[model samples]
Target: MIVSKRIAAVAAAVGLAVTGLAGTAAAAPAASTDLRLIAFNDFHGNLQPPAGSSGRVVLSNGTTVDAGGAAYLATHIAQLRGQVKNSLVLSGGDNIGASPLTSALFHDEPTIDFLNQVGVSASVIGNHELDEGYQELLRMQFGGCHPTDGCQFEKPFRGAKFPFVASNITFDNGLPAALPVTIKFVDNVPVAIIGVTLHDLPSVVTPEAIKGLKFGDEVQALNKTSRLLDLAGIRTQVVLMHQGDSTEGGGPDDCRTLPGPARDIATRASASIDVFLTGHSHQQYNCVVTDPAGNPRPLIQGASFGRLLSVVDLKINKRTGDVDRSATVAHNEVVTRTVTPDPTVQALVDKAVTLSGPIANRQVGTITADLTRTASPAGETPLGDVIADAQLAGTQGNQAVIAMTNPGGIRTDLVYATSPAGEGNGVVTYGEAFAVQPFSNIMQTITLTGAQLKNTLEQQWQASGTKFLQISSSLHYSWSQSATQGNRVSNITVNGTPVDPAGAYRVSVNNFLAAGGDGFAELKNGTNLAGGPVDLDAFTAYLTAHPNLAPPASDRVTVLP
Candidate 1:
């Protein structure tokens, strides 16, 4: 039965007078069993502790503490699991991809090993999982050496022990891409776990990576699978969703004004869903929203990079085989490094770090100061400017006059301080540079008319959100805050020359942007496409070419009030 029908039946039974039943013997209350769920999202293969702001978690008291690292996360999970007799470890997607050098260097096999050792029951497929394409994702699941780079690790690549579930992603033939639902028998009571990613996955990932896959609506796919679980007599349902929302800077468990896709989906989702474990926006919140049947359920997200864990404890009524909504409790816990690190997991981290040390520690260049991704008021960043310059220089052989790079690709800042590897101040290592641009996207130069370039600039203000492209120093443009979306950009120039609408210009961008990823649809219309070196190579080469490199100014794009 659907949730609405079940709710209506209960409503109709309320306030009924039963004089004869009062005289009869009273029945015993239904027995309930406790089931604990330990969940995290967007680990992103940080086997070692992440550095800088990404490694910290804010508390409700407005204080922050250092957190995260695979071994530390393992210790926290073990401690949480021990609190209940029946517990399950779950991930809300992005277990790998966009990882640090140690994990990404070995094709994220070490991270999978960590997840396997820690006993993750299942996970959702995040957008970054499709970074190397679907076939590679399949390889990550079923076990195999990379088709090209065979067996980079000591042993043959073993696949993830946990299943990657996705109800919405389907093949061209209308078959599901992964397991839609996983059933876990907790103390003889069946609990169903369903997973789905954001519906707008195509806009974020490279088009070629998901060539034959179709991403369906998250609510529809979730509801459909939920109904099936209900009919199968499994009423205790949980959703591990890769799409989430944000809140004002709050503590791990604070849920002040939840606003985003996750909240919207929670309200419309089936009441049978006992709890939602969400990610994607990388924000932390613990919220309760009323479902379609007017029942409040927990919707929680732990901060990304293993910095926090979202814990949901459910009381399953053994008689009805359903979760006791009134008894459900959820909160986010910080994965602090105070606990003793799990020795086994730590060993895996040690091995990977040792094997990757040679290439990871190689000095790439020097920086005079930090080149951060923190955007200026006009949306450009010092690191983004440097990346754009690098892309242009790498493609100059193709006569590329201007270059633009997306802010999303600039993952981390290049800090001038000494690193954990003990690299001296102002020194930049190959590993650090790789972490900033881990996608290994190839550079592409294309021909676009000046008019099309303007249209591309106009696309910065998309319906989803504004994504300001970072351009090389040679290109300059100003945008208006009051002007409408398509007409906001003006004063476009290249080397101080006014842009001619009909004139053809050679522009450079990464393959992801060149294929119109991030809603930059105008980039897809370019002609005379020419491919160049990989983005990481371009970045490192540029850094090497310049000594004592200072961060470029973020004043390229003028923002008109």
Candidate 2:
């Protein structure tokens, strides 16, 4: 199958018309082409079966099953493919980055290798794709030895066997950041697929990573590209979008309360769209929402980290190359452990273990209890608090008195019995600590005025949800619920002294935030910036230095009623 290159013809015509939504379905021509699309999202390079709640699949039938791992995922994908005459494997994105020690230790080559072997045709580029920066993302797609470290795997690195489609992302030169749209031909008919991640990807990743990139509005990109594809004679439009939203529903396939950027985009984008595949929220649901033309269309999302797969069975009208919308169906299938694991993918995972497992398994320290990343209503977590303290202590030499870590930085909970290593319970390993903070971001300390710090905290409440910054124990602040946005935070103090709005404070954060990874853009304005050890190392050192660590009290930030 020939993948699509950038389509320059539509470069000048980026935005599509957003006419008022309709009230009824628009009919398409009869006679169809049966094609199956098996889609998953946010694999996050979990080569091993994800432990704890991250890997369990909850079926609508009320039965739970342990699911995921590259091997099992490969097996289930192959099984799904076997049942269809014309089938293609798909992903919403984030197949790599913020990964486990198994894959991240080697820069996610094992994941790329597994996805290629399992036949991942194409996927949208999730924000994590730019975790290492844009050049690294290109390298992941085009193939090459790492610029800093040469080949680490058995052979020279070849890029993904798939194109990463991102229609909404473009460069300043007016070209798509990635190969925008790809069509998978089924029975000589083109099934148009346009992929785009969140328009706010820069807020979720290091700002520096996306220095030269421009993110087009999601609705505009979809609307424009769908129209262009329609003009080019392709009628079956499938959107592989990484931007996602969650819904309150009866079960896995309900769309009753569908609302978010994804839902908004679905209802406002071009009416030519047939199916919407998405990720980012990492939740699972198969929904049918009224499109711009008022026709109902399937909007699906697979649970994150290889836990589930969304199988979209599309009946494309052979006569007009349009989707038979009424007959389309989608299911969020659990990647159950009952299926026989694919030995080929298993061997690849095993080989990765052999190469990196030794260092990964080394004991770092022990904790008295589980230092979890699970946040409270205030978004404070035991792990995050600990990490914030770590960054503070680690950078004390740089005159840093305060530190804040992003909640997204904490990937997994610090489990007590997660490993098979017999060092007893509550024992922390290098790999386990690595899993908690996997971004490989360097430690950075910068100067922020007391007023700017408050502004940074206020920026958190401005997002969809309040992203409460994990603060060092030395700093304390009170938040008023009834207070307005900029004034919500108050009673700021450092080392028992109320912070003067004009006073300067030395603050530390991972390199991601120092360069404004999240929406806290003020962090970028800090001067006298200095980089220290990588984040994971700083975290590991904290655990090693503080034996018998305990969870911190969730009272640092007082929330007023």
* Residue pairs clashing, model 1: none
**Which one wins on TM-score?**
1
* TM-score per candidate: 0.92, 0.91
Clash count, candidate 1: 0
What's every prediction's RMSD, in angstroms? 6.9, 5.5
Per-residue alpha-carbon lDDT of candidate 1 for residues 1-561, written as tens digits (9 for 90 to 100): 123344333223321111110111226543777888999999999998887667889898988899999999999999998888778899999888999999999899999999999888889999999988999999999898988878987468889987888889999898777777776666556677788899999988988889999999999999888776666666888999999886787898889744578899988988889899999888899999999899989989998999999999999887788888899899899999999999999999999988999999999999999888878989998889999999899999999999999887877778888777898999999999998999999999999999999999999997666889989998999999999869999999998999999999999999999989999989999999999999999999999999899988777899997
Cα lDDT of model 1 overall? 0.87
Off by over 4 Å in 2: 1-30, 58-65, 246-251, 254-258, 420-423
Over the stretch 1-561, how does candidate 2's per-residue lDDT look in tens digits?
332233223432443211111112227533556889999999999998886667677666656678888899999999999887778888899999999889998889999999899988788999988888899998898788998888898468998988888888888897766766776677656776788889888778776788889998999888878878876677888899998886553345545444588888888889999889989988778888898778998888887999988999988776778887889989888888888899999999999887887888888888888887677766688888999998888888889999999988888788776475455788898988888889888888999998898889888875565677899999888888898878888889999999988999999988878777677889988989987888888888988999888888887888787
Give candidate 2's TM-score.
0.91
Instruction: Evaluate all candidate structures by whole-model CA lDDT and list the values in order.
Output: 0.87, 0.82
| Maximum-lDDT candidate | 1
